[model samples]
Target chain A: MSESRGPGRRPGRRPGVSDTRGQILTAARTIFAEKGFDKATIRGIARAAGVDPALVHHYFDTKEGVFIAAMRVPFDPAVIVPLLLNGPREEMGERLVRFILTVTADPQAREPVLALIRTAVTNEQAVAMIREFMTDALLGRAAAALGIPMLRMEAAFAQMFGMLMARYILRLEPMASADPEELIALVAPAIQRYVAP
Target chain B: MSESRGPGRRPGRRPGVSDTRGQILTAARTIFAEKGFDKATIRGIARAAGVDPALVHHYFDTKEGVFIAAMRVPFDPAVIVPLLLNGPREEMGERLVRFILTVTADPQAREPVLALIRTAVTNEQAVAMIREFMTDALLGRAAAALGIPMLRMEAAFAQMFGMLMARYILRLEPMASADPEELIALVAPAIQRYVAP
Candidate 1:
């Protein structure tokens, strides 16, 4: 219980500086990574961060709140929506796969993806959030722009996500270690056909 | 703790036909089905079964042991290996996919498949078991028989299991509702290509 903040009082009491909140996020990310979502506990995080559990609650009302803060996986349709929205129907799969590989291959984007998969099986809320993020940001924008039926959009996601989960999450030997380009090459067409005009 | 067996063994004979074990399996199955592993607890299963925690432990060494018993999923590689081992190179995909879909479509085969996925996320041992089940029974056999490398085999599994996880486990619309035949038709060729000579 190293949390110096008295109950209900903001820890920093300083404007534009949130060192403690940042520390908490750091601690939460480590714990979530180490223990996964379900097994990691608030008490454990507070113990790790050297902060009061109360402060954790104050900063984040629930575990889900902490998860959102810790992961910070942006759900903005802003960045990716236009990628799918502006694409030609026939080329959507190639574009989508290429975009995904680019996003995931970037160092910054990789960690959140790892966190997402780690939590999907361990936390129902995280699983729900993943589905929500996909449906709201990527799939919804995609199906609408391409004028494909909603079902096809979901099918495409199922295929795409399954590949990621199998390759990255489960670390299945073949897919887990495949050359990204080869993976993209094989999978891109499947994606293309799913939403293609 | 409504256990038939109390602390320190009774001198009398054992309970008839192991009624409590059956009860525990039932409760565990229900809990696992409803909660999908992360939330299901042995204590909870025992309580639901009107038995003591120790009795639950007595029957199954750990929660995992309980899970292995309760889910009762057939994780046989030897039985499944032969089915996949036969047939010409060209028809392997169709034969393999047909076998998987047809078997899983059956009520008996489906439950264990669900249980396997549900538990794989929450329990490390469950993950190990599933990995063994797939590798030993299915993946390794296919790779060895087809003379493909391990990496390609894993990639194929990523695709196959990914499809199964998305379509069956999450039951994410369209896929959950799609005709199995249509799914096999679209995806079987991909599976075939991955495994074929």
Candidate 2:
């Protein structure tokens, strides 16, 4: 297929590329949904996208990277993790709480997250991907930076995770509709107990 | 249909009819799953179960009642609510945490609950049913008994709800395998602030 496309076309650096990346992402979402995270592969996604395998790797460095892109998560852990670590240790809990709320405050921005939550509930592969992303990309960095055990970090993270589900997904009242500052005041202390350096 | 069955047949009462209630419950689950709680009716459930609508009403007085029965949740609010309220105000959080862990420890017993959680994520009607159940049957009674505003009660409940999802559904490690007592110690204080009378 690659040979038939053109004589001068290179797998890694295809010239005049316009929508190839977008097209690959479209195909990735479908393939990932159908085969799940564990079974879906770069080659399979490339084949589905009608692009070369090397091209898929060139555009998205890894499967997890592809997932992060396809899911359209607004903030990258690469940026957020460092920001979380750089903040004052005593206030990290409040910062973390504020971070989540600030990001999810916009309804349009929250769609991908809500979709991920819904999908993660039903799909084991999604769960695995989510867990990996949280532990490796997000929480692990915070734990490392604060010199705390990952378990402590995980407990704190779990509370925040629960809060998100309750307030957003379940729309549990009071917490759901409460002023963000009030909730931060209420929940930040609890989170601090786990996260405080 | 009553006449066709026979004389001496009671719409609400049939002797040696242990399975009638059970069959209705089975049918109710199916109908609820298919049409959701709002649209599933006593007549529809009865038809599916090959019974009379009067029998469903006789066995379960309301749709909420039928749902509770079908879910097979071991703890009844009538009993547990009093137990929660009677405990020391400071210990209410611990008791609540213990209650959730105890109820969900048995995987078989937790099946219906986990199922409801998963279903409620995607279905608005299911969310309504769940919110009503949690607010009315469970948390409302607790708040009333504790003499606290429902808003405080809801905040605490949301935290617990999130923990259950993270531990059971997402299976995020450490929390998933943590000692129940340790978790209770960690989370009880947070809950007490909400429920303390």
TM-score of chain B taken alone, every candidate: 0.68, 0.68
Model 2: per-residue Cα lDDT over A19-115, one tens digit each: 6787677667666655555567999888877789898899999987887887655446666666667868788778888888887787645655665
- The DockQ values of the predictions, listed in order, are 0.31, 0.44
lDDT of 1 by residue, B1-197 (tens): 12344323453644455577876776676667666666778888877666688989999988878877755444355554566667676877777667767767865456556666656655565676666656666678767877887666665566666667666655555666778787777666666766763
Residue A190 lDDT, candidate 2, scale 0-100: 73
Over the stretch B54-129, how does candidate 2's per-residue lDDT look in tens digits? 9899999987678778764444677678768776767888998898888888764565566666666766767877
Tens-place lDDT per residue, model 1, A18-73, is 66776566677667866778778888887666678998999998877888776654
Quick one: best DockQ, which candidate? Answer: 2
CA displacement after TM-score superposition, residue B152 of candidate 2 (Å): 2.3
Which candidate wins on TM-score? 2
What lDDT does each candidate get? 0.66, 0.72
True contacts kept of 2: 0.57
